[model samples]
Target: MGTMAALVFALLAVNILLGSYTVTIPDFFAMLGGKTIPGASFIVMENKLPQALLGMLAGASFGVAGAVFQTMLRNPLASPDIIGISYGASATAVAAVVLFGVRGAGVSVAAIIGALLVALVITALARRRGGTGLILIGIGAAAFMQAVVTFLMSRADVSNAQELMVWLTGSLNSANWERVGLLTIALVVLAPFVAVGSRELRGLSLGGDTAAGLGFNVPRARLLLTILGVLLAALPTAAAGPIAFVAFLSGPIAKRLNGGAASLPLSGLVGAAIVLAAHFVAVNAIPGTSLPVGVVTGALGAPFLLWLLIYTNRANQGG
Candidate 1:
C-alpha cells in the first residue's frame, strides 16, 4: 500500500511538474512560493495543476466505487463501467448537457439519478441470479444506455455534438479550479457513507450466508454498498465521463499486488496512478496531439479484460 501510494504521489508530481511544456523543479517550487515564471506559471496553475488534481480525486472515486462493488458482489466482472452504472451516469450527463443545457449540480443530480435507477433495476432483475447473471444484465443495461447516449448525440446540434463527443471521450483539457472544487466536495461528502459501509464490504465478500451468519445484515449491507458505489461512480462520471476502465481494473490490480487480498485504499491509489500516468502518456505520447485519457485506459483495459476472462475460464475448468 505504501509503495502504491508512493507511486501515485510520484506520478502526481511528474504529471504536474513535467508535461508537454516542462516546468523545471525549481520553477515549480518557485511558482508554489508565489514567484512567477513567465510562460510556465499560467500553464501550471490553470492547465496542469487543476487537471492533475481533478484527475487524482476523480480516479480515487472510481477506484473506491469499483473496489466496493467488486468486493461486495465477489465478482471481478462487476465493475461499474461494465455493469451499466457508468454508462447510466454518462447517459444522464450527456442528455443534461446536450438536451437540457444543464451544467454543474444539475448534471450531477441527473447522473446520480440515472446511476441509481439503473443499479436498482439491474439488482432487482438479478436478485437471485448470482454474480454472473448480474454482470450479464449489467452489460445489457450498459448497451441500452449507450444507445440512448448515441441517439442524443446524433440529434444534438453540431456544437453540442462536438462538446458531447469531447466530454464522452474523457479529456482533462477543460479542467479548472471550479471542477476540482466540485469533485473534491463530492469525495468529502461521500466519504463518511462509504466509510460506514467499508467494514461490511469484506464481510459481505465472504458470501451472503456467511455474512449473515457472522451478524452482518446482508440485504442492508448490499443496498448501502450499492448506493455508495453508485454515488462514487456517478460523481466522477459527472466530472470526467467515466474515464473508461480505471474502476474495472483498480481493485483487481490492487488485489494481485497484495497477494490476492483486497484493499480499497490501495486500489484507490492505483486508480489515481493509472489516471495520472495515462493522462501524462496521452498528452505526451504524440507531439502536437493530446488524445483523451479514456483512449489510453481503454487500450490498457481491453487486454486485461481478455486475460481476466481467459484466466477465469481456466480456473473454473481446473477446479
Candidate 2:
C-alpha cells in the first residue's frame, strides 16, 4: 500500500512537472498560490495539472470497477472493456462525433447513455442464467460494437475520421479543468457505494451460495456492484475515451502485488500509477511524435494478457 501510494504521488508529480512545457518546483508552488508566472502558469494550471488529475481519477475508477467485476465473476477476462461496456461507449461516441457532429459534453453524454444501456442489457440477459453466459454475451456484444465503430469511421470524411481516431485512441490532449472537476465529482458521488460494495464484493468473492449463507442478498449485492462498476467505467470513458487495458489489468496486478489478496484502495492507487506512467511515456518516449496513453498501455498490456492466458490455461489443465 505504502509503495503504491508513493508511486501514485510520484507519478502525479512527474506528470504535472515534466511535460513539454516544464514546471519548475518553485514556479509550480507559485502558480498554486494564485500568482501567475507567464508561460508556466497556463501550462501548469491550464494543461498539465488537469491532465494528470483526470488521469488519476479515471485510472482509479477503472481499477476499482475492474477489481469488483473480476472478483464477482471469478474470471480474469470479465472486465468492462472485454464485456462490451467500453465498446458501447466507444461506439456511441464515435457515431456522435462522426455522424451527428457532436463534440464536448455531448459526446460524453452519448457515451454514458450507451454504456448504461449496455449494462442494462447485460444484466437483464444474465439474470436468468449463470455468469459464464454473461461473459460470452458481453464478448459478442463488444465485437458487434467494435464493428459498428469501424463502419462509422469508414463513412466519415478523411479529416474528421483522423480527428475521431485520435479521440478513439484515448488521448489526454483535451483534458481541461472542467473535465477534472466533473470526474472528481463523479468519484466523490459514487465513492460511498463503492466503499459499501467493496465489502459486498468480499462476500461475493467466496461464491454466490457462500455469500448467501453469510446473510448477503446475493442478487442484490451483485446488482449493486455491477451498477457501480458500470458507472466507474462509463464516466471515465466519457472523460477520456475508454482507456485501453487499465481496467482489465489493474485488479489482477494489484492482487498479485498483495500476495493474492484484493485491496480496492491499493488497486485504485496502482491504477493511478499505471495511467500517469503511461502518459509520461506516451509524451516523452516517442521522439518527434506523441502517442496517446492508451497506445502505450495497449502495447504493454497485450503481452501481459497473453502471458496470463497461457498461465491460466496451464494451471486449469493441471487442476
Tell me the TM-score of each prediction against the true structure.
Answer: 0.97, 0.94
lDDT of 1: 0.90
Q: How high is the CA lDDT of each candidate model? A: 0.90, 0.87
Model 2, 132-212: lDDT tens digits are: 788888988899999999999999999998877887787787799888888898799998998899899999999999999
199: Cα error in model 2, Å: 1.0
- In the order shown, the candidates' Cα RMSDs to the true structure are 1.3, 1.7
What is the Cα-based lDDT of residue 23 in candidate 2?
Answer: 72
Model 2, CA-based lDDT: 0.87
Which parts of model 1 are misplaced by more than 4 Å? none
For this target, which candidate reaches the highest TM-score against the unseen true structure? 1
The per-candidate count of clashes, in order, stands at 0, 0
